[model samples]
Target chain A: MKKIAKMVCILVVSLVPTLGHGAFQAIGIIKSVEGEVYLISSSTEIQAVSNMKLISGDNIITGNDGSVGLIFKDDTVVSLGPNSQIEVQDFVFNPAEEKLSFAARLVRGTFSFITGQIAKLAPKKVKLTTPDATLGVRGTKFVVEVK
Target chain B: MNRSLRVLSFLILSSIVTVLTYSGCSKTTVVLLKDPEGKVGHLVVENEAGSVDITKENEATTIAGATSKPAAPKRYSEDKISSQFGEALNMLPTQPKHFILYFKSGSTELTDSSKAQIPDILKTIELRSSEDISVVGHTDTAGNSAYNMRLSQRRASVVRKLLIGEGVRADHIQSTSHGEANPLVKTADNVNEPKNRRVEVVVR
Candidate 1:
């Protein structure tokens, strides 16, 4: 019986990460889209639509007339302008465990960002990287353009 | 004659500075703006060369390259900014909304006044196409910590069921419990606080 109980404990511990939270959960949602926006994940590209859940590691690409808006679980808002590409590199918002992080990369084009709970709770953990420089956000609204 | 020369030189220098600031825009540029609440936060633009801090609204910095430092922040006109980033700025998502519902002590039942808010809550969830809702439960310090945790979980589930019955998708709702760890009103162990026994629903 003791051996069986130990095995059960190990199974539960291993399953914790894959539960309906953490890395398996949706990090944000596409709130608005215009023109020709596409979401690329796992080498698959799909036309972007409002209310679509987005996970980390997903790439958002826009055409010449495309624009998109997204809202993360922690209320962070990100918008991309025409002819833009951005990657959601990392995002973790687990307030209960005090594990908070937000990171993204803008390869080109224009971006608008508004800080959320993650930045307010742990400002240093938030980062927005561009080709030339990286922005360390401190709970603010900002815009970036990369030529 | 010297005074006039100084004024003329100042004008020339100012114009030159303006030209440099605006002309070097081929690289990455970051501009700080105020939030919807009219609050401006600071940002740090850093690279291998150095870092530039932006504090004021409409302040901007340009980074020429990875090896070069960020430029000193300069105030940009509203017209210039709108012309560059108007599309992105206009696409910002609406802010999330939060609602709190009080619960009866030691049970999954909601208070009378809180029950009356169900209609409004349902309306909020209905308005958003792919709305995501989080129902977090909390309890006052009126019981054992272990028991309180279980109680809060039940409370959260209760709210979750109510939303689902009202047409909210079960997959869109995430239910969790914080027990008495996060109390609206702090108190000693085993103290009963009505405000602390509540569930918070965030609609995004």
Candidate 2:
């Protein structure tokens, strides 16, 4: 009986490594709150169970009723009004020197952006392609509304 | 009278004179003198209220009871891009080139074998395209969250400089460190997982 108990403990210990490997990647943080997700940045409240895919330099905020805002590393800040779905398809950032690259897809929502160093360093590098028109920014601020 | 008292009286008299002068002038005369260059001598309509100032600029036109009209909106055609450039952009990779650099336990530095891939990756980007590139550094959960975040960004910047040195335009690439925000395997802290330390590339 003693031998059997020891063997069982060893088996459980071996399986522990495999069991602890499932966690969601954090892309952003929840900044503030409004009727919906109002403000988002590096400093915001994020629930561990939210399962939102967050990358470095991602700022995401969700409201009680399901509004969201997403800010990316490229200094591209997006505010979602309500019941919107936005995904940060890709993002890259270097904090020490302030370099960044980001790409996001707005499936259905209203969003706004403030261009970051990526747009300033290489204006052509940042591209926001929408259904109607593709927006290319050369260090400018603009808003977009999509249905 | 004392000097101060006299000065005060003079100021009061001047105020009275200025008020009388303004009141004596007709509204039209006041409008004319105020707009010597006639730059502001135009009719303004707000909501239902409308006012017309017949100054020197509009006086040249001999039409009686002429009202100002809102400027016409200029029509603009869409700016077209050359097909050659458009085609080139379309052929580029839509997704970023991802490289997962596994690190030792509690370490942010790249492993020996992983460092070897950096030069080749930089060369490929330099030779293939002239567009901008992006490099993002990531880390696994091995240490404090704040420290991991900074480490990740530093790693990404290292890769960005390497690419720039290999003839890729420095202005064409940007880098960001995404600390431990996006982990490949979301396990508990101090896991020292290899999949976590990675720098991803996207060429646009």
Candidate 3:
């Protein structure tokens, strides 16, 4: 059954330019980790670790007994419990310019989210998508479980 | 091949039975979200049942399950937000750490005790291999709303710089100002409250 989880294998060919002068490249950071976890970006799968950087469009997967926590540019905290996979579908934040956006897809497993500065600055811009539903946030703290 | 088709069948069947009649084989994906930052926002939840708007901070909304069109949204209190997702939260690591730092009246300066609290914060951060820190500023009701707004911004900026100076990654930290709107203690207009003149920090 796990074989059905086809990997998109994204090859971030678009070079990430320098910051401040352009769009902010990195959107999140791995704040914590336990057990088995991996980050599938482009066509690569990298083992997860504390402090690992996360960018938009990366698919994160965790094995049994594995959990990972992440923090975005807006201080939004999202932690994934064991045997789960989630994707950072979209993220955009530029306070000086008043531009903000956040969207994610929790494919399976459990993950808790605490709204970040992006939601507080722009609530309408925050959203979380699931297999059967789409969630809009108002600077909140809540968890999602997909069975 | 059979396994993948079975999974696909499950998805198709779930959608087909998503109407008024629900089947026992369907998978229910539950979603809960609460806004504890006290930011008043109109959040939209769209699904098979219809759509509902979410407003007010500390308030929460939940969708019972989704292998089909999800059930109608349900709202809950702040404390109930986590408990409502108890099954999911139980699988997570220890709860995130929260810290409250007090400020002087009408000033961005940290109080004596709060200043002392910085060391513990720094130590805790050092212990973690990875970190995302949030520093939010707030003010009491002693000044005009506009004035307090700017004051809160100044306070958050002051603390953000402090953390950055202490070696926290600048990009990983988020700083915000809530003015007098989100007070720890409710107070009448023009009333001063020490607890309200503070900063809230969360380390995840």
Candidate 4:
């Protein structure tokens, strides 16, 4: 009976589309791309294109003459200048369960960020990390340059 | 001999100044910028040594390393910011737009004024190269939550259909119902709020 119950539980879990949160879902969309921008995901790198869906753990790299812009599901706007790179470290914007967070790392380049609902809902949840220091955003727009 | 020594000392001092300037340029910099609406926000730069708070627009700070504190905040001129961040700024995407359309109490029918905004909404969508639209339905707190949920769903569907009829791609639109859970105006249970009974369409 216990084995049968375990099998039934597994079947029910598989039947549901979502597992209570937006896991493995596209968290943002690339709005614009100029020049030679590349997106690296799951160890595969491809040329970045406008309107491409972005998931967590993705890295965006721009060539010397490339630039890109993206908007998260929570309306957070981020843009990169030429020769810049950034990683989407963590993103969770499930307002229903009050799970709101945004984090990114700027490896080496110029980046502009505009906070969104996640920062408005929770001031301390948004963070941007650079090679030298970490930034705690308090609902604002800012730019960073890592030499 | 004394004159030659003085000239040698001067050369050493200028070289030291050049070295310091080069190191300063290598430090990472963070600059706060004004939003499109001209509002400024705050930022906190922290490291192992200490933290610096940036409150004013155009304020900036530099960090040398992970173990060093951020430099004191200093405001930058508009010209300097533009020169350094022009590429990033130009690449920024347009902010998402939102429109609220009110409904006739407890019904999916849109009010006269709300119905009139459909053309404007469609025009905005047409201007964008790629459109991702969302139509969410909401209701007042007058009825039971379960019934209100279904009503809100119907309201969203009605608006979605209208947009589709106006030549909007059906795939670009997504409809959802928040019921009485999310309200525009806070109200007691079983209270009627015309402002609360509405559908919000977001164009991105």
Candidate with top lDDT is 1
* Model 2: CA > 4 A from native: A1-147, B1-96
> In terms of DockQ, which candidate is stronger, 3 or 4?
4
Candidate 4 local lDDT, residue A10: 30
Query: Which prediction has the highest DockQ against the true structure?
Result: 1
RMSD of each: 11.8, 23.4, 12.9, 11.2
DockQ (CA atoms), all models: 0.32, 0.02, 0.20, 0.31
| iRMS of each prediction | 7.0, 23.7, 11.3, 7.8
- Report the C-alpha lDDT of model 3 over B1-204, residue by residue, as the tens digit: 699999999999887777424334224344444335443445566667666565544433445444344454455555564554543454444335668899999999999999898877777777753356777888999989999999989998898899889888888676777788667666789989998898877665
Tens digit per residue, CA lDDT, model 4, B144-180: 9999999989998999999999999998876777788
**lDDT, residue B143, model 2:** 85
Candidate 1: segments with Cα more than 4 A from true spot: A1-19, B1-26
Question: Which residue pairs show backbone clashes in model 1?
Answer: none
Query: Which has the better lDDT: candidate 1, or candidate 3?
Result: 1
- The regions of model 3 sitting more than 4 angstroms off are A1-24, B1-28, B31-44, B52-69, B73-121, B127-204
Worst 10 residues of 1 chain B by lDDT: B18-27
Off by over 4 Å in 4: A1-22, B1-26
lDDT against true structure, model 4? 0.83
Please give me the DockQ of candidate 1 compared with the native complex.
Answer: 0.32
Each model's lDDT comes to 0.84, 0.45, 0.68, 0.83
In every candidate, how many clashes are there?
0, 17, 9, 0
Worst 10 residues of 3 chain B by lDDT: B19-28
